[model samples]
Target: MGRNTRKRRTPLATKAIAASAALALGGGGLIWANFYASAHESNNNAWGNQTKAANAQVATISCPDIGQKLTSVPRQARTEVDGELGNLDRQITDAYQRLMTTRDAQARDASFVQNSILQPLKDRRKAIIDRIKLEINRVGGSAPGSLDTLASCTGTPANQTTAGGQQQQNGGQQQQNGGQQQQNGGQQQGNTGQQQGNGGQAGNGPVAADFVDITKVQPNVAAKPQKSGNASTGVFITRCGVNANKNHNTDNVIVAPGVTNGAHHLHDYVGNQKVNAFSSNQTFLQGGTSCQNKNDLSAYYWPVVRVQDGTQDFDQNADGGGKEGNVGKILTPVQAQIKYVGSPTSKVVAMPQFLRIITGDAKTTTNGLANANAHWSCTGFENKVQLTTQYPICPQGSNVVRTFAFQSCWDGQNIDSANHRTHVAFADANGNCQNGFKAIPQLTMRLVYQVTPPTVQNGVVKNAFAVDGFPEQLHKPATDHDDFISVTTGGLANKIANCINNGQRCA
Candidate 1:
């Protein structure tokens, strides 16, 4: 009405022109409007995408106390493009690798013979551990605990105490065998030998965590009594060595707490404070995600500890290429320079001269290079003073363990019958193997003086670290007992004859 009220008709060509003009005006307006609408819609889409990504940057790690749950300690947000995640991840991963090495050694020395079998395994395991630790350290807040660190710290334990006594005894039997794994950690253990390691899990004498001084502790022969007054010696004919078939023999030095069955990498030597660990050697039964099926070795299990005394023939192949062997020999000058920072026990004896071996032993094969990892490598483990702590703290949390133990096996030789050399070691004022006892199995055990009460402290669980090892054993032969009869040319023969004729076994 405002623009076109008249029905104006003119010549036919003129009228067509007017209609075309009107169509052009409406078409132009619609076209311009469409362009504006498209531009506005695109801007909305771009902003939506930006907002979504901002939200995706992180999800809070819930610490209800913090308005935003803290995944980390309130660090800046990281994104795939920024490479922040990878940076944080690398550090944590390195720590995991170091810890793996510590765990591997502890597992290797579960028993005396176990180390021989576990040496190679420990190497491979260390490599794997380094890689794993690297991954773990890179990521923040992994399975936080010391369980893994304490499990793998190797070498002879500082405190290997005895509940009964710390010594091995010989039976009067002629035929004997000695058992020792050179610490390569065997590729495979035969079923027959395996039965004795894991409790009734393996066989008759599962390796307990106790290695005794063969020369120090004597056996009760359990022979027929010759004396008028005396009770029988209780130790005679008790289980000697354990086997996978449940058979035991005193003919061999059974690796204490060796694998009649193995729990592998056991954590919580005392109880409660568990650190993070990585391995398949966790608990087979109920436990956390980190728990693995493994073989466990502890000073508490085998109270007897053996420090290497001397060597006439020690093959580098044995001792995990010095993984368990003492390769450091002080030069005459260097040793003289060592000053006693504190006093050693007056009861302590000096290390016998016979204990030293060739210094360059296992030089090439078992070098620490093979064990280098960011986590707990053997490199960080040493008998030296810590440069940082100035104490003997292993660099990694996995460096030293309170429950760590020494390894030993019976060479199946008679303690009474054979001429054998033995080495002994003990802890001084500080828990260290500085003091050597002048005896075979020439070592003194670090016994625990402080007993830890199993109570939660101040509503916070407190874990105690205690030194553990042997209480020493009686080193005497039976004077008079039924099994202490005089050895006659035919005394042994008569017992055999009686058993055979009676269809019974010898007592």
Candidate 2:
């Protein structure tokens, strides 16, 4: 399951409703309503502010194969990349906290500004970006475009160079709001008043910690390893085909067909050797397998979530241009689950090859309506649901888990639907498949991330996690999608029936 983090502004209509309520209530009641509305609005703003700073610090980094990139990256390479990013994250978090707590520096001279924040921020950011580029290239991927990492800082009060491009000291004279500050040898800094740089710390634009760290409040809950062959429990299994080798390519005709790198997004796929944008049932059955069980060939896939490097190139939405559907870093899933679910009397039936089922909608033009079913939880705190872009930051010993449940009730005929969803419906709360709809094997993916939560300050929650998708989309709990194919041989399907119906645990 993957998604993008976009700030959800209170709709104008919602705001109007709040205002109307305030007017009808009158006086103190109005005060409470207004306060509630303001707090509600602030939550979105806070997330927006934190995300802005976070993305800027990530700077111009390129992740090749953008879709299947993370999973394809070597395990050691991923750990190194995360370490580099985690360090930058910590630095930015510190700088943000400092800027938030520091007094306004409008009265401070450029020299003090340079030493206190600007220089350190620029030097640290440059080093991190350089390191990331080096690491990506080291792993056989192309390095990001060469950039003047400090270009954004050129016009700031500190780091301004002379007309001759020479380092200079200012005359220590106070300049007007839009006037040039005179430098040595008759040079002058530009009249652009305190431009916002890559490092969002300037005279009046001191960076504030937009989110409070919530790690302490929600401690981590460790997962106990599942024992095998308990016989008292039932399990479902999906033997997916080959791991999708490329990121942007797809074979699913329902979503995109014959489109190479056409998703303008990335996705991770398992199952169906011929899986791509144009794949059909015939192609899927002929494809090879990536799964250990060669007899069970099926397709399973979902979007990829990347960690943004400072370049802001991951998604078009992150840059304020919503033309493309998804951009930014694509994160890999932590774990996955596949099983057959039906009534006690029902038995497992092989689903048609290339049968496509998408659970979460990825192409959400709006924020709230998409990702309606995406589920996020702490390993031990499964009941506490997290729905926003700021994914849960699990406490020590616990992991961040994402769960996607696909519809199991198929129409018994159509392998696909126009909307890519209607062909199936979810199993009932009692775990019973719907009437008339045949219960096929249900595939659920549970992805876990081991990440320390951002330090919460002032009671605000800061999210350290970012998902994969269009940055303009909300990435709410609903964007998670899952696809499946049935390659289960007749014998394997019966085995599933015996194991599940008889209440015997088998994996």
Number of clashes recorded per candidate: 95, 41
Residue 148 in candidate 2 has what lDDT?
30
Give TM per candidate.
Answer: 0.15, 0.49
Put down candidate 1 lDDT per residue, 1-507, tens digits, no spaces: 111111121122122122221222121010001111122232111211322212111101000011011122112211211122222212222222232234334323324212432243344444434443344456553422331331222221111101111111135211111111111111212222221111111110111211111112212112221321211111101111111121111110111112211111111111001211211112211222110111111001111111111221132222211221211111110000000011121221221211211110010111111111111011223221111100011222222211111111112222211111121122221222322322111111111112122111221111211111100101001000000001112233233223333334222
Q: Which stretches of candidate 2 lie over 4 Å from their true place?
A: 1-233, 238-252, 309-330, 342-350, 363-371, 383-390, 452-463, 474-477, 489-491
Summarize candidate 2's per-residue lDDT along 45-115 as a digit string, tens digits. 12113222121121111111111112233333544554554454334334433433332341233243335
State the local distance difference test value for candidate 1: 0.18
**Each prediction's RMSD to truth:** 37.2, 19.4
Instruction: State which candidate has the highest lDDT.
Output: 2
| Model 2 accuracy (lDDT, Cα) | 0.39
> Which residue runs of candidate 1 sit more than 4 Å off their true CA positions?
1-199, 202-507
